[model samples]
Target: MPLTKEQVIETLRQVNYPGYSRDIVSFGLIQKLDVSDEMIRVHLVVRSTDNNVAQTIKRDVEAKLKEAYPAAKHEVVSEIQEPPQFKTTASETAGKEKFLAGIKHKVAVASGKGGVGKSTVAVNLAVALVKLGKKVGLLDADIYGPSIPLMLGVDEKPLYDGKKIQTIEKYGVHLMSLGFLIDNSEAVIWRGALVHRALQQLMSDVAWPELDIILFDMPPGTGDAQLTLSQSVSLDGAVIVSTPQDVALIDAIKGVQMFRKVNVPIMGIIENMSYFVCPHCGERTDIFDHGGVAKVCAQLETELLGEVPIDARIREGGDGGKPIVAMDPESPQSKVFLEIAQKMYDKIENQ
Candidate 1:
């Protein structure tokens, strides 16, 4: 017996967003549906960037369809809607004049939640861009949990040249972070206003060299720090990082919406720790389950820049104050970072 559109729809109705009560079919995520003989094709439009949700929906839909008709063949087509465009205001233009004067592009590495390796992405991305022969600078704007210093192996305090503070140079990229100023044991317990002031100082007071790009390692969340940075500079765009999980995707969605609200162009999404490859046996494992970020990016109409699998060496490199891209440029992992960097550079250049 041939499959029917109603049967396919009913099958899809079994799949739901991880944290939501609504099913894919009921949410109007099914943009197009076709049924012919034993074959079925579905075009799905999802709004969340959670790769797991999308994969789950696709898997369930296909599985149920096959269960109903053993001879059924099916295909799922997904489309992500682009975020709404926001017009820049006069004040926004004025804000850009205060900092980042000579830099060609300023990009932010952000995430909805912490522990998604946002800083690691920023550090390696900056290093990758540098390897591509472009000058770059990295600013650790995560005042409370600044890890840029540890990741880049920078320990000395920034020097002052009377006119402005001098950034430390390492691996062909300039660096700045609150980690350089305060003692590692001490906590940044300042109020929101104080945090903003310090960030302002980092931008306006630093004697950053003329460079092709500056990447800000932003703190996680849609908080005051993010707002301050977005409102303080003319950010070229933002790259969101997330893992292939529902919790992380929920936050990633918030981060994307926040950037859109503030008028920062979203360059794309990157899935960090998308999967794990065992060293001894070379077996692949979806440690956190995969494809959530890709689905989210599709729904948001943003690019899925690339995916970085879970590797022990990546963690070891960061702890040793060396990013994989700089320490092992020829490694497969390093190539991933370089490729993502190239995509970003191309996007900025084309813009």
Candidate 2:
């Protein structure tokens, strides 16, 4: 039989910490504790500044879990969360005025690696926000793989006045992507300096007149492209996307780190393809095994925006050049996307 939550908590209590009376589970360090079909997954958070204790806790947790449940498939991830510290007014207010200019707020959509549907989320999110009567703009910063144009069905090239580049509007949202300018057959090969210049030009030169929210479809990975783009743009926050697989989470953490290093507040995480739903019987299957993002979010002490299940319609809509949110606004999946955008707006505008 599969282990219960009670059994998991009991086993954790047996694993002690150095010079501490409370156990790992009781200290409220364990989060997203889940068990299904003899498979176990959980995350343990420790202070990143204290390297010795963090390593010890990780090893102790892994060894204890294996001894208790030898036959079960287990995955335990450890994250180091540094408690928030107060900063002086000078540092905190360095770029606040410059960052919030004509745009009310700017959010970057990022992933640890490619092929996690980061661009798709960016495109549909901008559209969803527009549907809610918000003036939204989508900037595709994935220079190499600029998919925003194709995703938004914008084929015609953007018109340019002498001074600034005009934004192409589709589905009530201003959009700009490298895919619109560059030849599909050609490639964009540039180094960090050049790439940074290109992104800056896109942001400052584009006439994205009076946007309530601007979403940058950031390139995947924690490479020069991402670091440069984050530095050049006055970002209000970031939204991370990841799959439920462990490999995806590994990359997702790198993304979170990059944003944190740049001091961009992480709005939340969205777990795409969290699970697969059987349409016939309305049954849910843990295809990739869900809760990976939730576990990581709890470890990092960040909000979980929401989870998007793997559905045929999502893929079909992308392939058909029609976003699900624009095609079927009344569907449950569309509702979830709208809710995420709304929650983001509340976080930025209300605060």
The candidate that wins on lDDT is: 1
Off by over 4 Å in 1: 1-15, 18-86
Model 2 lDDT tens row, 166-241:
9999888888887888897788887778888788778777887888999989888887777776555567899999
Tell me the lDDT of model 1 at 60.
69
Each prediction's Cα lDDT score? 0.87, 0.80
Clashes of 1: 9
Model 1 lDDT tens row, 55-171: 776776677767766676778776655456578788879877779799889999999999999998899999999999999999999998999999988888889988998999999
User: Once superposed on the true structure, which residue ranges of model 2 sit more than 4 Å away at CA?
Assistant: 1-100
Model 1, residue 229: displacement in angstroms?
1.1
